[model samples]
Target: MADDIHTTREPDGTTHTTTVVDRDPKRGGGAGITLLVVAALAIAAFLGFQFLGNEKAETGAVTEAAQKVGDAAQDVGDAAQEAVK
Candidate 1:
């Protein structure tokens, strides 16, 4: 904080004084911003990991469906060969 005083003399030989008060500038604001950024990155990483896990589960399901279809196809081919015989 800062204070300033001004004194002035008028034409009527009267003196007037005034005081001004100023606020101090803030310091070390960067630490709060850094903390916010770190928090945001942490949340993003957590969400990304969760999404990756879900993707792996979906991929496994798709692979299992494909395998079942392939097995069915093989069984149909074996039945056709038996019929021809």
Candidate 2:
């Protein structure tokens, strides 16, 4: 918010003047940026804890799923062999 002025005198003795003004407002983004960063960090921390907390349970569940799949495959193979006989 500043004003710049210019003045000139013509050969006819009449004075001409011009004023240029800047009216843009200036503000700080630190508060918004700080809030965003804090929110992101909080989300990351929450997800990290959830992942770590369920790690062992997830591994055991995966192992059980694999074994069940293996058993199902073996049963299908046996049925196919019997049909081929």
Best by TM-score: 1
lDDT of 1 by residue, 9-81 (tens): 9999999999998987779889999999999999999999999999999999999999999999999999999
What overall lDDT, based on C-alpha atoms, would model 1 receive against the true structure?
0.97
Candidate 2 achieves a global lDDT of 0.95
Question: Candidate 1 at 59: error in angstroms?
Answer: 1.6
Q: Which candidate wins on lDDT?
A: 1
Q: Give per-residue lDDT, candidate 1, residue 52.
A: 100
Taking every candidate in turn, the Cα RMSD to the unseen true structure, in Å, is: 4.2, 9.7
Clashing pairs in 2: none
